[model samples]
Target: MYGLLEVHNPENATSDIVFVHGLHGDREKTWTKNSVFWPQKLLPLDITDARIFSYGYDANIAHFWARPADNRLDTYSNDLFSQLNNRRAETPAANRPLIFVAHSLGGLVVANAMVDSASNSYQSLSSCIRGIAFIGTPHKGSAKAKWAQVGRQIIAYFGKSTNPELAKDLEEKSEKLAKIGDVFPKLLKRRNEEAKGRIELVCFFEGQPMNIGMIVDESSATLSGYESILLNGNHSEICKFGSRDEENYTKVVGHLMKWTREFENSGTTEEAKKVTNDAYFYGTNNGLQQHTNSGTMTLNFGMRN
Candidate 1:
């Protein structure tokens, strides 16, 4: 589901910012309006040197006639990380510093992925992610869950099928969301303990109400003691912007700019281990050239006879 959202010149990019869509959303349509994809068109002007990507996945709460679906959120979590890791493995942007901007359930995926990334097996991928910025994500149980439950029941009733695992997770006071709210903070704490700068978090919630009222209220959309912001739009449009001048777009871009600057300055999470190596000269008159990740160093020692 990791699709490259922008056709950027990878040579100039030093970092990556990936966007993931939520339930019943498309990778392209979620962030696009009137065929203008803001991440590709508007975002580059501010974050010129960062590679952009958007992830996709099947997010059906209840399949018609109980169709087979991957209903586990943890499975989605694993897939997101695994697919992203594979995509970047051989690319020029392989080890560039990474971050995320996710919406709705996509935000949950990002959090769970990051939580999984903390383990030893994923150190390489985890070390590169500096932060995540969320838009209208539910960090707590939401009012929309009841409707989701009803919808699932209706689908099951027609098909004579039972509700799937995903339906239960979408209910208010979802067992999964509870665990994420509890464990996500602990994951960030562990990252900080590793001496790699602590992962940064920025959350956003919709200020305006839909016909159904605030599907995810402020308390549900944001976490306590973290940076939370307001977007003057409904839940569906909170993550979409048609132009660079929109207030929501401006605010989102402003946060992204700040993140890029911070990541540019934070340097690598892993400190370079100092090692001593003997220099060897192949010829009487030769230059010793040492190569490094940032650049090259050369020392010339010669005699003109």
Candidate 2:
């Protein structure tokens, strides 16, 4: 089966929201707390006019030894495209305005998916995206990644086999990670220019440290121009909301509510008609434009784990 799972699909919905989980995260469990999945139980209650889907892929870093040498971000992006296309074929509403909520390495996968969409085969899927919410995504390299590599070495020394290849991929200064950081800005610039500010970006960073230390710091989690919100949780906890009463849950829902209102007000069908297929590949040489200073907001719920 395709790794895409439909969480809440309302009949009168106007847009589509897709959630992508991070490394070692399951499609359902990643966004759940106290036996309740937020995307299904809470998000639908707030943003009623959009269908929700959670995209899953094999994100096990420990299984890197079993994967091909060429298996990397591009491979994951291709798989994402295939699953999305398969869904589109089965349901025509999949073509509606799209928004992405990605966590950790899932952000990289989404970025690569957008890049892949510039090619002929995936243009439609790329063009459908209107907004993205990045939760604790390491846009730059993270110190925790380096520590993961060291931890793997320690495991290997103790006669426990581990995937060095995957460890290297997560390392702070790894060439693979650096290349993604370099190219992603250019891709965003091109996409933003083509969309004429129609595409929106919001980043959410963790305020607390993970068990292994901070997996993604504020500097690594945020992009330069977008609005970055600091939530009161660690890397994993940032995505998990126990109930609608939590401030973290409110912030996420508020963002989506705003996006959906703007989407419907702006006229979705008309906007889609305006975008040409060549819009994806047309603006490679344009310099990145300065985004209006939307500024950053730090939401301190004062709840810590």
Candidate 3:
């Protein structure tokens, strides 16, 4: 997932766009599957003079999210971002603006890398970053994590460390549940203050009946300069990076087109609006459609607690 990004450079390419996938996903599977179609669909329309690239990391949904406070998984954001910067330096591409296209946990990774100085690479990379598009990312913590905590406790009582299988499973569950309540909103607050006018933040969320709203209202929300949009798709299918499905693919392309237009026309800052809703704001996209049946489905890709 690291190294030179493969892209199509039309003559006179204006800028570059970086596509970052969520947890448990990588360059090939994440946005490349369906979302990759954006550039081709919008190029003639003049949305951007951009090319697409993906970032990779070592992520395990079962363990990483369960242990949010663990420094190992948390450090991935900075480590991967550093690789991206090195790649860009090694190969000079079109001088077009740089935009970050992230999904689910990927958004959090990007947000953390941008705001936190704990990672030395963050400060330098933040300056070059222009825009950020987050799909189904929980800028704030998700209720799903809270539910996972219950499951973790159950496993702890019955399946404690005496048995390796039980112990490992229990740990995985605990780590993911803990992550749901951690990071996100806190990261957003830090990101907003650090990046300020340098980065343009846009959120595209799932608005279907089962789909939850991005940030699900400002209370859970923390990021600033966020222009959010709602779509009629489940957490699994929201951004079909490289999908052949015309309809699903188009939804993402359309949003990108609109986002590019906004970036091209307006300056860095966009008006921030107040969102309203309770904890169960958008509800959960339950049933088999969620891709994971352990419990509740995740809004961003397959990362679930």
| Per-candidate count of clashing residue pairs (backbone under 3 Å) | 0, 0, 19
TM-score of each: 0.75, 0.77, 0.58
* Per-residue lDDT over 63-95 for candidate 3, one digit per residue giving the tens place of the 0 to 100 score: 344445554445666676666666555433312
lDDT of 1 by residue, 27-142 (tens): 88899987888888888888898888777777654421122243367667777777777776645344567888998768877787777666635667776777788898876533
**If ranked by TM-score, best first, what sequence of candidates would result?**
2, 1, 3
Preferred candidate (lDDT higher): 1 or 3 = 1
| Model 1 root mean square deviation, Cα atoms | 7.7
lDDT tens readout by residue for model 2, 91-171: 445457889999877887888788667774887778778899999887753344543553353334323344444544444
Comparing 2 with 3 on TM-score, the higher-scoring candidate is 2
Clash count, predicted structure 3: 19
Give the Å shift of residue 234 in candidate 2.
0.9
Q: Candidate order by lDDT, highest to lowest? A: 2, 1, 3
lDDT of 2 at 113: 82
Q: What are the lDDT figures for the candidates, one per model?
A: 0.68, 0.72, 0.51
Q: CA lDDT of 124 in candidate 2?
A: 71
Query: Which is the leading candidate under TM-score?
Result: 2
Model 3, runs deviating above 4 Å: 1-4, 32-48, 66-70, 91-96, 141-198, 208-225, 241-255, 258-305
